[model samples]
Target chain A: MHLRTPLPPRPRPARTTRRPLKHRARVLLLALCTIGATILVSAPSAQAYAPVEIVHTEQVQVGPYHLTVGFSKWPLRAMQSLDFTFAPDGGLTGKSGILSMTGPGMQGGMHMGGPLSRHPRKRDVWGLDVRSLSTAGQWSFTFTINGPHGQGTGTLDNITILAQPGPPLALSWTLCTLPVIGLIAFLVVAWRRHRPSRHLTVVGI
Target chain B: MDSVHAPTLTGPGQPSPPDHPPRPQPAGAAGAYTVLAGTLMSLVGVSWDVQWHVDVGPDTFFTLSHLMLYCGSAIAGIASLVMVLRATFAGRVGRPADPTVGGSPVRVFGGTFTAPLGYLVAGTGAALFLLYGLMDLWWHSLYGFDAVLNSPPHVALFISISLTMVGSVIVFAAARAQRWGRIGLVVSIPVLITFTPITTNAFNGVSPAIDPQLAGTVLFAVCFILMGGITLRRRGVALSIAAVLGVMQLFLWWFSPWAAKAYAAHVGLPLRDNLRHMPPQLPSGIPMFMLAAALVIEALLRLGRRRGWSGRWLPQLTGAVGGVVLSFSMLVQTSMLRGGAGAGPMGPSTTSATTVLTDAILGLAFGALAGYLAARFAVLLHLNAPATDQEGR
Candidate 1:
């Protein structure tokens, strides 16, 4: 018969009186640093002062109307969320407008049209709020304005939208699904590893 | 189980060991306990996601909240996978299936793999959840930026996770012989109860005196309380689950708001104008009458046993009775807390006599439905097949 041996009890640590002020100061400093870092990293990618900075403006003259089409971000990139503003010269009193967009992939120029509404945050001009174009190619914005000055139509054509920012969608999906494949392989290995002795007539059932 | 042969008698004066040995816990085991934890994390994440939508507007594909939600689902999936594969391997070797995996072993892949009913169901739910999650991203890409609760893909996701929670409940119900199993059952019942509540979170905002949304979710919650009694076949199982549920409810009450504000501040986003003065839209609440309803169920269940009642109707009746009691409980709580009568979070109360009556009536209808469904589910979980169905006994 084998003799049983009991495990030795773990020794308790000697109590040390820590400097509360010093410890608290370190913790407070760490917290402040973390807060400051988070604020810096997550600041919204918009100018805080003068929220809409119109980097590029295309002047479209349709009959007597002179319309200024403004883009918040220039060299427009597809899938890049930004603002689009349409400001008719001499302010917007008693003037109503509709904006329609036609892009390269759209067959026969079937326009995506809607009444131009003022941006919720920026009320001075008719605008699209945090919008993104899906395709990276030539696109056009058509504007229709109706007022005492009579109705007029204008188009800002050959507006190039660059390729979407970041890696390809397909590539992202492939990377995401890699773990799924790995999980399947792991399951197969696990099954084989724990499997009991296989003998007799039932072989590999 | 084949691993569990006849009790091993070590030597003279030594006691006979248990029929099955305790398995090691990996990521809190491929077991019921892990499912409980996983479901809770997922619900917390859901609460956070809802709050994020309310306060800060649209989110990208990856948020800290979304990650937490995905992590929860992944844990459940991994746990179910491990259990199923191990069980399948053992069955293929002509070994006895684990006793914890019920008598009616669900064979798959042309009878080659032995799948435990709970794990199979849970694994399938997890797979569906992941698929639906991917679909959610596509949905966002196709139709940009809107925060509606009952979106098609989001609903599909909720249903899948609910399936996982149901499977977790079955896991414990099947393993009632162990102490851990009993405790796990207690914990799991509460987790499952909250599963539907997260779907009704939108109602928590903007002043609805007696939220009609509560009726549907209360039905989901109260039925599970009855399930704790019916499936466990014990006197006080419902009460135990209700007690555990209170702890969860209290934690959520505190954690939901704190997490929402903390994350919003971290992201440097301002709260929307509507939500500037509101409380957190919690995914679930205490369900005010649960404790009382549980005691009622315990009494009725004990009485059923004493009378030697047999067959299916008892659970349904008990659930119906509990449902009514809970509806009234909600009525009392609302009256005391709202209608501009008290300092409740429901905001500038609109509770009228007519509204209260309407809520109670609707509550009654929902309660009956909840009871009827809970009865059938409890029975399904409790089903035991004859020994002839299994091999190498």
Candidate 2:
């Protein structure tokens, strides 16, 4: 008796082929391309900071509150006494405070002149309680700079205060545990083997 | 053809068998190892260099947890890349392709080009963001971008990343149509990460009106979801890592208040004053929960490695399980440590336990559901790695 045979399913089309470039040639091309691209992307940004002027902003994080003194072209560390207040808006209710400033000569930039006159003195930097930041807005601080040169007045604007905490959960422990568990498992297995091997040696009958 | 076919006869055969099935050829294990190594390195560079740590308590997004997030990525990326590249080259030497691994003969071009293009986009983005961050920092500290520490690094990172991306793309395109197509796709993620803006709002000063913590949490959650989905499609160690991330996110969110309080109390920081600076409260108890879920998925994917399963599926499974377990445990530990006045400078409030438990449960549920959904979707979408018999040459 003759049996009928079933035909096989049609095969999928073969993948197209190409003569791949040599690895060395490709690497060289890649390097050259990357260099050319880098030059294009970075040239503009580099030009933006050409004059190399220093911009300074004084900021202090006391407790949960943030007090930014604002941006200035000149160094205000030379000022002896500073006083500032906040207008009622969001959180602070006409709250004001004072901070005394004394520190080593401010480093970086020759804009501040020489060693502050060898005179021993305590400087008053302005302060604010900032007990609460209920409102989200800017605060202004006006400083009366009483430097030896003369009395200069400067205003600091839009000192923003962000209220937040660190990330609630931490995964460091978990990461650390991978090795720890492996180590512990290793130790446990080693102990089990060593103990049996050492204690179970057959004694002379 | 005759010379190549002559070696199979084991002996000076009395009668050579008519159709001796091609001798089971030795598989390309070395290539596999190289790809794995390359993937690990790439993972490290992307995670650490591109996305630096942001410190926020439970109120924020899922916890990044020091530098590990970056470190792990670097390890995974570099390792995978190395293994894949080596494997690709191994074919040149006439090594037999492993039956399980070399399914669906993809033209090297599409595979290579797409992957590198993705990386170029991502890497360039990250480099730009890094520059932005540096500028922001300079703005914060120096009031401008002139300082040496601040500006030069910014310039360097930006230029370097751009260059790297460009090279990466070229390599990808050049290597396109090779077996490294899938691997290239994976490596391109860091390049993508480079583009995402981690900070915003410059006119209003550096401080964000949008709580970074909250934003971060959401960002991590979204990443976790994507990761879970990716794992389902790829089916490997990556999923296990995702699971761990999800659990960790849950633990952090649930126990954030306590952890914050503990840190504050331990360090003698005031609670009301601190929370005041942050965004208004949300219902989220644990920001890290979602992250934990991601980690767990990744961990579980990795487990397949131990079971003699070597393929796309192992990474997702091992990654999912491991990530979740680690994240959850850490959360619990942190919460407990930070819960009481005696323990630290901060005092524990009523919301501590409730928040933590809720986060834990939610994380667990979400993680499980995500894993299930990912698996289901993979089947539905026909994303399964092609079997050798069905794979096209």
Candidate 3:
């Protein structure tokens, strides 16, 4: 039985260091670097300012139309630039819209609304570009859309707004001056440092 | 009480001195002063740009502020380029290097070009800034309206402008013996402020637990104030610089809001930040503190002189004491900026006492360290005697 054993079909390949394993590792490293770079470039932080990209939306349904209202930033704040988008699930081909925005104390009515314009960035939806809500309170947007189906109107109401971001512009500015004021007082006290001296020659330029 | 320079640069094969006294100026002095002027213009543009962003909303590459910045850089860049080319040509023709470039101009591009150290640095910075300016256009093109404020292109532009200003400082520093040279140096003193914005940016990335704005404000305030007092050997120099900076700040105050409001009205764009105005992004109130810090440093120097106190630790010790005042003032500044100046409820009084105390102690410690280094830098740059020179006296 031992004599009848056949020779192996081929000798096992030599196990010296080769290109395939190193090549695969190099590919993996490259892939990892790409992912890391992408993450760094794309990851959102407390940026200087954010671009107008709709990240979240609220829905408003009136008559036969279902509209999605999108905001560039969430948890809306006063005095912030944000894009607002109004999209119909059906598409924008045959539709026309007018939007009227009312402040915290304002009343909503047919006379307050107007035609909605296309968002500069969000081309597919009718919206406003880099618009800001001036005061923190409950606000509303009245949308009027006309299409083949018929005219319909809806109100997206009671949107809550937080206080403005950053410090008080005026007060922070006043506070900034405090240090300078102190510095001035100190200098006035030390004014004698520049008094004319016998050894000091005022060189003429 | 006055004496003229006794030719330290006299060499063989060079022209002999005239019987009449020479004016204390090097050939490259004009270029250096122009560079300073250019830097001033650019600084205004930078501050204006910040205001524009907050008021009129996101901007394009072709905004008025950008134009101002670009134009100012062009002025500086052109001046540096001309000086460099002139020096290179003169060097090629076998002339001696300008004394203002450290008595020897630096050779460049395999000896094809030679330039004064100052102009070379300025030219390089300007060129880099130009490239960054181009890159900014690319960034805008790709990103469209509303790019992040602290984008890579913006950072690069800031660093480049700083480099140009450094070159300007070097030029005046190199020729400190001249009457104009001393004046130029004084004019350039406010340039130290560029550090504040850069360091302040750290607040974005650093943890609130660390309280990074304190570090930026401390080092910037402590080092520059002390260094000015030490090197100029005059209390008034720091005060004058502070006054100049304050005036600029005032102009910015009026100009920023007014311009934003006016521009917005003109363009039909809204200026929503009408209430409380804008929280100034730059070192709005910090430099004014330099007046006080400078006075403190001057007092310390005087005391040290009487007591014969001299050592590496001396500046640090003085800085530590003076830093306390500056540290507290900075807290006020941060409160205003962070809380919307006065409009927000979270003023310094509202913050926890323990936290403010922690920041002050830490800032004082850091200021001590920064003061030492700044003093060293001042001494190094103190190439000429501190003089009371008058223009056209």
Candidate that would win on lDDT: 1
Q: Determine the TM-score of chain B of model 1.
A: 0.82
Q: What tens digits encode model 1's per-residue C-alpha lDDT throughout A1-205?
A: 9998997885442334433333543563465456434433543321131266678888887546888888877888776656677888877788888889999768875877578766534567777655777689999988889988899888889999988756676664454444335435533542453321221111101
User: A1-205, model 2: which lDDT tens digit per residue?
Assistant: 9898998785443435633536543773465456435544543443321221224546544333444442223323221111222221223333333332212322352121111111101112222221122223344443333323334344454545332222211242232223224435533543443332222111000
Candidate 1 regions exceeding 4 Å error are: A1-205, B1-30, B200-212, B274-277, B283-286, B307-313, B333-344, B384-393
What is every candidate's C-alpha DockQ against the true complex, given to 2 decimals?
A: 0.03, 0.03, 0.02
Query: Interface Cα RMSD for candidate 1?
Result: 14.5
Q: What is the CA-based DockQ of model 2?
A: 0.03
**How far in Å is the alpha carbon of A202 misplaced in model 2?**
52
- Model 2, B1-393: lDDT tens per residue? 011122211112222323422222223223333333333333333232221211121111112321332233333333333433443465445463322332212223433311222222223323343333333332323222221111232333333333333223223222222345334433433332222222111112234333332232333333434433332233442433334434433443344344444544554323332222221122122333433544454444444433546433343343334334533543554355445444432334333565556444544444444343334322311111212111212
Error of 1 at B236 (Å): 2.3
Q: Mind sharing the TM-score for model 1?
A: 0.60
TM-score of the second chain in each model?
A: 0.82, 0.32, 0.82
Query: What are the lDDT figures for the candidates, one per model?
Result: 0.63, 0.32, 0.60
The regions of model 2 sitting more than 4 angstroms off are: A1-20, A23-205, B1-96, B99-105, B110-334, B340-361, B377-393
Off by more than 4 A, model 3: A1-83, A86-205, B1-29, B101-104, B273-276, B283-287, B334-350, B382-393
